[model samples]
Target: MTQQPEKEAIITVENLEYAYCDFKAVDGIGLTVKKGEVFSFLGPNGAGKSTVINALITLLSLQKGKATVAGYDVSRDPQKVRESIGIVFQEITLDRDMTVWEILEFHGKLYSMPRNERRIRIEELLDLVQLRNKRDIRTKYLSGGMKRRLEIARGLMTRLKVLFLDEPTIGLDPQTRMRMWDYIRKVNKEGTTIFLTTHYMDEADMLSDQISIIDNGRIIITGTNWQLKNTLGQDIIYLETSDNIAAIQLLRTLPSVKDATKKFRGILVSVHKDGTKVLPKIIERLRENGISIDTVNLKKPSMDDVFVYYTGKEIRDDPPGKNGTLTHRPGGS
Candidate 1:
């Protein structure tokens, strides 16, 4: 047997921490994002997702611990880290008065890109983001989606290895969000590592190759979507019956059933393999035991289900400004 080589980490953090006054915004969290991977930090508002990103990108000073981006130490080589990565903040930072072309051209110039090369790269990125037709239009005139696409284009102005997108599609419609996802996929396919943070479960589920669920300034869980869901281990069988307690005990003893528990008024069983195959036997056994089942359902776990399972609550977009700097309220995990 041969051991495979480990994938190189493009972004690495070790016990990273940041604080404001007495509040520890990012509490000793650490993660690694592999080269060309779409790594997402999924959490509610003010879960310290943004703070961690800020630290990684060298925007916020690291109060403690260490981080490296694109092989450059964040603290020692902030400029190198900045040059190696691009950032799209939660707030739009585009110049509304400038044309899309002008904005990109300016960014390219700021990076000291040669004129001819800048022109060619701008054209390529404009087409890549599907905004060639809107290139001459002022940014203020472009729709939210177009502006976002332009921001993405601008982020790619430099030859970057990593791109950080903070809540990239928070306000877009479903169609537009899908379009953004397509663009993001295309970028990732072309080999730019994407590091994004979003509270949207579906967005994380669809876009991320690796996901870390952060809550109340701490990482509650981290894994691929399937890996995270598989931690629950087996499909959930829900039964609303005449006697929940008796049904739980009976279901738990079955070889095909992994575990069974009482959920509210229903008996929730974790079925070992094919839930459909086990359903008939469950029903038969319950009937034989004189247990009357009123309703039955077998469900595969979703990322949202997994999120609630780990964090003990669903993701919520708490309004900004209500709680000063940190907006998310701490919940049981």
Candidate 2:
């Protein structure tokens, strides 16, 4: 018998593009999300991550290239795309006046879910998000984390095949953030493909099976966490076993060495590039100085280093509030 070809990816975009005013928001970007995989679209602010997701959600038109989700053209069949996907945005959208149970019931009814099924769905979601205890409490009384869990549970009301979680744990406490991560994993295990965007490097490092690093509307890198980090924050150690000290002066001439600081018995070498690859030659130089090696250390940069390498900026450097007011940026990290 002939072998059957593998199925098409769950989502595909060909030269997909969009712009805002004079600044291009999404510049000929291309990506694919596989069935049942957690694919992350990661980038710093002003990098067009939000704009691309908005286009997929049908809030913006597809001005160039084609985008298809679950075999439905995003532009031509928006309703079908919407039905097949669930979205949990960065912003929390809920009425403070209503209790948790009311909002979930109302959300189900909006989709024309049958009364009996709506009840079953509500019970399941409440338990799924661990909110059964808060079902009757006003949403306003819940903490930041609780509200986020509610949003996740509410998204499941539609029984979606794909989930878009945009910075799902943005401003919650560390403990709360971990809780949200658990909830995300639980949902994924139940058979949902997820498209996640996040600024928390640690979260992205731990969660995404595959990640695309986007910068200023273009994808600059794509790989699993280990592979990608290897490209950026490489381990490089500074060494100077030379007591001759004159030889250390010659080592400073190398362009890759950023700064060489003299410590008690050795030097702490920082590099603009990987120093491990330069280790052998460095050892030879020390031997020429009649120096013998006693110690060497290797230190790799963190995910923060990877981010700066791509965008040339730090995520936390951005002003956290608008008009210098907290009210304008509630729950924003």
Candidate 3:
């Protein structure tokens, strides 16, 4: 007999669907996270990333198909799903008046873990997230970075098989965000399945083992970060200035410009798919237009570029659909 794996899949989603009033939020979505992979759901805002997360955790009722977290069905066995998952919501969930240690301890008791085990887990997690020194401080007094770190510690209090983080470092500084990535990597290395959603391209690129780009309540693409990167036809050139009309005119004459759109006072221009080979020409054309450049950035086509290419909108703009409250679980944003 072939020796099989012992621990079963930690999460399964199949043909899942959800709608708010007349509009669907998640459309026939499906995914499965193995025992220890860091799987990511990425999208423009309001693309139903929250909707799917909510369904998976059993916070929102499933409108179609099925999902199982650990071994329990999402619709029929929500409590079981809850038992196996720990969540760090987009909206901060820590009790502001409670000390960091106190919050983790309180959350641990809710999961019915033994006192000894909970203590050990909390200590270990605090160190893992680099928060051992700040454990006694009340959450409200902590800096945004510190509070985010404490939330990581709290999320691990339950010894969860699946960890869900939604936009984990939205407003953090670059250093803090990078440190958080390191901590998240540490968690996945300890054999927990990490699931997260982010609108930030860099965060998704740096950490996700595989990424699913969802738009308009449906997944537009799903693959490893490299896979998605490789799929893009060419690189992108981004230009920012204080003149929208001038910015558009600046890019209009560039033979390499495949597409150009005015964004506020600036214009984001896409080079021809094969135009990446002629990078110098792109710049010369801009200079000819006399568009005084405020900022010029070179970027490979990212998940965001891929989303905009298909949807014709920026990542932050909410899609046209029935609006609904986005709650990924009980203590969520």
Compare the candidates by lDDT and give the number of the best one: 1
- Tell me the deviation in Å of residue 225 in model 3: 1.3
- With a 3 Å backbone cut-off (N, CA, C), the pairs that clash in candidate 2 are none
**Comparing 1 and 3 by lDDT, which wins?**
1
TM-score of the candidate numbered 2?
Answer: 0.74
Q: Model 1: per-residue lDDT, tens digit, 221-295?
A: 999999987876568787899988888888888999877766556765767688888999999999999999999
Candidate 1 residue spans exceeding 4 A from truth: 128-130, 173-176, 237-272, 278-296, 316-333
Cα miss at 56, model 2 (Å)? Answer: 0.6
TM-scores of the models, in the order given:
0.79, 0.74, 0.74
- lDDT for model 3, please: 0.75
In model 2, what is the error at residue 32, expressed in angstroms?
1.2
Q: What lDDT score belongs to each candidate, Candidate 1 first?
A: 0.82, 0.75, 0.75
Worst 10 residues of 1 by lDDT: 321-330
Over the stretch 1-333, how does candidate 3's per-residue lDDT look in tens digits? 988776556788898888899988888888877788788887656788899999888889988988998878988988888988889887778889999899999999998999999999998888766788888989999877677677766776765788998877766667767878887888888877889887667788888887887877887778887777656546776666645566676566766676666544455566755545655675566566665567777777887666555545555522212122232211111
